[model samples]
Target: MEISRRRFSALGAGVAATTLSGTLSGATAAQAETPPGKPAVRNVVLVHGAYADGSSWAKVIPLLQEAGMNVTAVQNPLTSLADDVAATNFALARQDGPTLLVAHSYGGTVISEAGLAPNVTGLVYVAARAPEAGEDFAALSARFPTPPVTSGIITSGGFKWIGRSAFLRDFANGVPRKEALVLYAAQGLLSTAAPTTSVAAWREKPSWYAVSKDDRTINPDLERFMARRMNATTIEVDSGHLSLVTHPKIIAGLILRAAANS
Candidate 1:
């Protein structure tokens, strides 16, 4: 079944389907079709996790562009799960053909809810939380030993973010110091409720995963469990939670592999 345009509205989040219109224009159907022998999926939509903006995908975007793929990185509002899913759905709605939906960190949750879009053909989770339908990610992650970054969270109002020191030391440890500093500076504050939404698009879609072996923010062990649970095509990389930033080449490659399969 398709994820309805009224999904968030049905949940009392008040997100209007018309909000998707601005991002919904794209290539004609013929131009959007994948060339023969190329990946069956021609569009790639990226969703960024908590404490990040779409710029979080900067490192991977050019690589995908160089490979001749149409790519769009979603700017999640980080206000709530429903809002983030709405933003992601807006991007997915714009794709003209088969599309590969990719997520990093908390973005995995957003894609899990939005990936049911009719044109979404596959999912790639990069060191992300992949909770099953009716699962509570916070409770799920709690089953694993708490990671270092958990202690660094600073909640203000209803939004949360890792402290700068923790963002650099625990979350983005694999990233270069200078770059990590900039990422920390641009971090988005995330709603605490996002993780409680239990939808699992990976359950219905062919999925791939890249687990960051050295991840301290989301527990590498938890990543493995989720990857296994989804029966995803999985790979492990030596990196921190922000693998998409620190290990873009392999992450992008995995995404390409998922796209090719579509």
Candidate 2:
């Protein structure tokens, strides 16, 4: 299902045209403009990564809702890749029509497994992992200089998280001070045995990526490499790892682009 660069270029051009027209409002708008027999995407399923929950998508959710999209933010268990993917699939199954699957941080890994669902038409990775099938994301990330936040991850018993200090300084650096503190207090943790994937849906689905230029959680270079390798439509934002919070408009715009293109 790998798309040729030429095909992606053509797709990107079409998306750019739709975006410029400013007519997209949701699946309805896409449907009205679509050529016969094309899928119209209106549903969006969001997945959050380690150290966060579904609330991580709070900012982007309202924006998408205002655009007339039916949005569902999944509450991943973060216990294992299988459990998280199951949670995403549960959300995906409720979508009435084609859906745009969006992921942040480790949530990207969840969507990589669950996005193969029949209703999923596209994927948007926001400063998130886009591991190839059978690829070890940790090993892949090792190719780039490790981001400072990785060193701050603290594991106890079987779960992993960053302390409030590390969360504020490294994980949510660009976030407002007060809000970063709140996010730290509500931090989630991942199980020690969370597995990587061998079935990345981006292989067949059209994908978009948002790279945080100043990201300290995941290296920007690593994000770029994964985006390029997946042939995703990529947008770069100058923000921290939590770009979805700091730059909701940009992330929502990318999702809309994926919706139009789907």
Candidate 3:
């Protein structure tokens, strides 16, 4: 009995040692990827807004991944604000540690609500809406000149899509034609109503914003106003609404900065 007990104890110790060694190696590998002076924020959740799905982030995803960060681009069912938030939260819940929550277009509202999750360390808005909780986002945008893309929205069965003409000319102005066609075909059908969030996470969380200078889908002034209102670190990209497609490197840089600061 004593001999058997000793063998079991030795086996257990060896297993524990292996586990500890693996954990340390993993930590070292992750840390190694982060450049000095940049604290590592290893997980990133990207939320796409109305008229787009996860594929909207195709260009940006590889950039983030190449930097050795785990990135998830959320495919929100644009049925309602709550639904999209749920989808984002689902992605956030899967992250292992501190995460940067990034959003585009109407996705801003989603991250605002879902960013309240404890794992979320920061919020990054790329040409996204950032309305005050319960504020009328439609009315707010109306205060700005109605974007030209508004004319192209076609609605049926309570879901909305910007027709190909508007998507090509206004939403995807700077994107290559071949790629823009794929985006148009795969755009999410958004809810016609722009619902307000109950709470804006940017109210307390650290944040960053990228404003597309030639955006026609959402007013650039509105994006700037929201960024200023949230006191977010802001950068302006000289691209249209699809800056994530045409100016991915700048977007990736902004996100990396957010990750470092998170």
Candidate 4:
């Protein structure tokens, strides 16, 4: 459903904060440095997880560009896990040289699989899910007690899902009240099928993660657990579920670091 204009502005502001916070801290340093010529890295492909779309990365795009990095924010259809991976891989195939694949929320599962792309140089997770073999979103969520907000999204058919008011309660908790309302209003209807991954994708890729300590949708503990398993470089942000939007600069810095290392 489309968000009302007023709500959209609020959501934009909230997401803007999440996307730029990473760069804001080192603003002077980033501004003083010359943009890497041509392309220091081929491209950075951003994948947004469930309940959101490409707009999620709007705030972070400029920062990447300012660093002279080409960026593509994949607009995942959120129909099925494999489909999302294929879409991401298609994006990866179009880029030259090394590429950084970044995922948020459920998007992590997509990157875990799609990251197998030959061009991928690194993987980054922003408060995202990093699943192991045969683990689906439900299985992972089952391992942890259902967070109060998630407990409320009822699915009537197998693998079909809907968000309840709890979407506002959990995912958007720390977001401004007005912005949270916009997010709640604009949130996408995700497929239960989208969260289930067939195999572990990060085993072969160099990876990193940004954990939102106060995230309610996916437990922060789960983020740490997955990061440890992947042997990923980790950074903790004191934000909520939409950390990318709430703390973009931190996320951008991590992405820039990943790009530099790759």
Candidate 5:
């Protein structure tokens, strides 16, 4: 179901307020009792985009955990953008300390709208969509044409997504050929309706964006535009759409930076 512009605006406002409250509360608590020389804080919450589950983060999770930071990956239902946001928020609510909300592919839209969760001190976009209010994936793609690689997707109702071959070619292009093939074979069909995001979180949130210079799915130009508009700390990588998988170290470093700054 498409979220109306008005509804998305309302949701954005509510989420912003919720995030603000959380930020303020955390700040207040931090000021109450803290030694001057505290180590840099690091808490990460990862959100995967459409057609993928939390397992998409499997390759990167251990890396983050190994760095001595707490991490949580939200298993979004990929049902609707709002539903995904709610799931992300639920994960955020369960975390202790501050958080860096990271999004991949369509998860960018989810995090853009839901990053307002109180503990969300910052945001990291990994070759993901960061749409503004009233924007959908189709609208953003139109500005910078991306060769269509979704012809393999099969949907009974209104759901739309990429097929296995398309996933390997477009989504997992720069990844290891063998692993890309494996991921393509194990890919999930996503709800087409979820790409319609109602709110824009970049306008208010401090965000960091990772641009996949070799992305075959989302255009690199659009990634640059979204990052510029959000005034985000931007990092460019020569990877495909699944940079989080192929270049987890780079993505992790950016997340760690954001968490540290937060």
Candidate 6:
């Protein structure tokens, strides 16, 4: 079933279809000086998670750039955690000033590490994971209901991908079927071997989270736990896991908020 747009308007502090709360993510407002001799910028770097490519952010980019913000989407190789982090850092290195590092899904894990780059001023997590340093993500996920997407995994040559049926049904739950097909066609594969982070950037940098209330890929409750664990400013949208694709403005709005607060 598709979620209605009206559900977007119902924001609150409870586990409803939509929610927004200024919970403590334990982050501070103190601004770190831009690197000496480096000019600051209102830049945004987007990171896409497994089973997807940078094109996933196509809808959100225009909105951000139109608002006079510099935007770049990182093309993660999805081969390993280190490779994805390197790709993100490379994008950050190219930014002219303080940047908001944003991620969707597994991409959340990317920013949690790359965000430590001195130029990043804030973080935005959209229906994404925000694991602590050395945390066993699989173990953590196990604490929640197993997402059916796990059954949709297709593995070959040590790389893993989501089956088209599952991508449309679960991973891209609320996205239009046609667009979800395109996303599946443009999807990338992740390594079968699990990747972990050494540090959690949300612990240091101010953070914002957009929870996909109707998400089927990751347990909705788990998303809330991560957002509250980091004490992030949080919002819940009545959409699926691909909120970035289905609700670009909402994601964009959160990024703008992060930019303003950070």
Q: Best-fitting candidate, measured by TM-score?
A: 2
Candidate 1 residue 33 C-alpha distance from true site, Å: 18
Q: How close is candidate 3 to the true structure, as a TM-score?
A: 0.85
The C-alpha RMSD in Å for every predicted model, in order, reads 12.2, 5.6, 14.3, 8.5, 11.5, 8.1
- Cα lDDT tens digits, model 5, 1-262, are 1111111122211112211222221111111111246554567889987767788888778767876788999988877777888999999888888778899988888888887777777788888888888775686678787554656566867676677778777777878788877776666556766366566767766788888888888888888888887878776777778877876655665665566555
Give the lowest summed-lDDT range of ten residues in model 1.
Answer: 23-32
Per-residue CA lDDT of candidate 1, range 191-215, in tens?
Answer: 8664665578888999888878889
Residue range 1-262, candidate 6, lDDT tens digits: 1122122222232211122223212221111233456544489999998899999999888877776689999999988999999999999999987899999999999999888999999899999999999998999999999988889988999998899899999999878888899999988989877788999999999888887888899998899899889888777777889988887766766776567557
Look at candidate 1 and give me any clashing residue pairs. Answer: none
For candidate 4, the 10 contiguous residues with the lowest summed lDDT are 1-10
Worst 10 contiguous positions by lDDT, candidate 6: 23-32
lDDT of 4: 0.73
Give the clash count for model 6: 6
2, model 4: CA deviation in Å?
36
Poorly placed runs, candidate 3 (over 4 Å): 1-38
lDDT of 4 by residue, 1-262 (tens): 1121111122221223222332234122121121356334548999997778888787788878876788999988877777788889888988977899999998998998888788888898988889886776667668876666666677755443336567777877677788777666666656665466666668988887887888888888888888888888777777888877776666776687667665
True lDDT of residue 109, candidate 6: 94
**Candidate 3's residue-wise lDDT over 54-129, tens digit each?**
9889988987887778999999989898888888889988999899999999999999888889999999999999
Residue 5 miss distance in model 4 (angstroms): 42
lDDT of 4 at 257: 64
Give Cα-based local distance difference scores for all models. 0.78, 0.80, 0.80, 0.73, 0.71, 0.80
Count the clashes in each prediction: 0, 0, 0, 16, 2, 6
Model 6 misplaced regions, further than 4 Å: 1-41
Give me the runs in candidate 4 sitting further than 4 Å from their true place: 1-40, 156-164
Candidate 1's displacement at residue 251, Å, is: 0.8
How far in Å is the alpha carbon of 94 misplaced in model 6? 0.6
